[model samples]
Target: STYRLLSLVLVEGARVQPHYIADTSRRSTLLELRTMHHIRQAVAALSPEGAARIAPTRIVSVHDIAPAPEITARRNRLTRRAYLGGQYDWLARFAAQFDIPALELCIHVDDKAHAFISEHVEQVEGEYWQLRKELVDTDLSLFRYFRFPVLHLTKLEMDRLARQHGFHEIMQKTWFCHSPWRGRPCGICNPCVYTAEEGMAHRLRPLARLSYTLLPVLSVVREARRFVRRVVKR
Candidate 1:
């Protein structure tokens, strides 16, 4: 399945341009194609296991040249759609062209942002539950428009799923790796700090621990940088 999917991508590249094809003898995975210079290098890195699975093929570099203002505007709109959960259609189209099944690997759960805020707010203030409820409703609405099969799992549930998918040990070890502190999770931010703490408190899964460790620090740094830039602009 992986080989066929890659072949189709390569074929698409051929249709786009003839000279785009480069030998991919070293590349291990399709992700290496993201870098133009690494195309051949990545193809060279492919393991025997990967080679036996897929055919050795030349890859093409699909470069986007600067266009006129109207073309740029259209490209921006298309890019936005591609980012905001609209890439599924693109994938479907690609799959149809290659006669392959377009499988969606969905990871659905509660919004970490709301969950984190709820934990920090005073329970007596009644804002925590209200915000949490709103997030739940928002997530429900978001899922209604999702066309793929979504595996709705809590932080803990996701761990179980990861283990089932043969990444149990990796998931467990990486959980705490993202923490701001060595042993304790940061109790702020949406994904890393907040989700980490909650998952740990509830023994959600070892896989989810790292986000608590690392994400808060990164988010804080980014927010601070943004604030500084805004103040400078003012």
Candidate 2:
């Protein structure tokens, strides 16, 4: 039950391009994909047919959708609400491309992140919570298969469930760093910092991870690297 639907999404956008079409021929092959196996395991529970074809999601980027070209573009940062909008747009495109009869968009943002979403509107400068409840309430028709079934669980609890599904070893193999050092988790980015905070990566040091989360300069550099990687195919 614990492993029912935990939310820890660190899938490589490149892997599920439908073009790659995973050759899940053996366990060792799946292990090479690291954390994606956890997702595959979950999808298997929902619909075995969908799980079999994991390579259909390409060009997946998290952002906002604005009327202006600049705001909608990846160059500008999206407001929390716009970010959700962009996600919806992406799914629409995904379904169109893959000819998917239907798709289930599972959103399991962490408790730490959820602490920021609020519909009441924040006049404060430094706020982190605000879900675009108003927008979602209006045009419900846009989301044909968007499902956030596990907002009740925290990142820690969800991750624990992930490991519970006989994926403890593979979970460790999962990569989160956008700018991995020689193809390994930088272990200092925001996600990696959370990973350490939740006691997910024992190999990462306590002080270093905390320091990385606090340093704005390092955050920018890492985010830039991720942005570049997402736009350009290397």
What tens-digit string does per-residue lDDT give for candidate 2 at 1-234? 113222222221112332122324322333335445565676667555545545533332223212333223421232344434343444544444455542333333443423323223222233122234554433332443233344355556666766655544434445455444544556666556666666565645555555565667777888999999988975
lDDT of 1: 0.35
TM-score of 2: 0.44
Where does candidate 2 stray beyond 4 Å? 1-102, 109-145, 197-234
Q: Which stretches of candidate 1 lie over 4 Å from their true place?
A: 1-99, 110-152, 158-221, 231-234
The TM-scores, one per candidate, come to 0.30, 0.44
Backbone clash numbers for all candidates listed: 23, 11
Error of 1 at 129 (Å): 30
1-234: candidate 1 lDDT, tens digit per residue: 111122323322221111222223423223223333333233335332322333344343222222234333433454453333232233323333333333222333443322223332223232111222344333222222222222234556656654554433433333221223334333443334434444644433343444435555778998999999999999
State how far residue 207 of model 1 sits from its true place (Å): 15
Candidate 1 C-alpha error for residue 10, in Å = 31
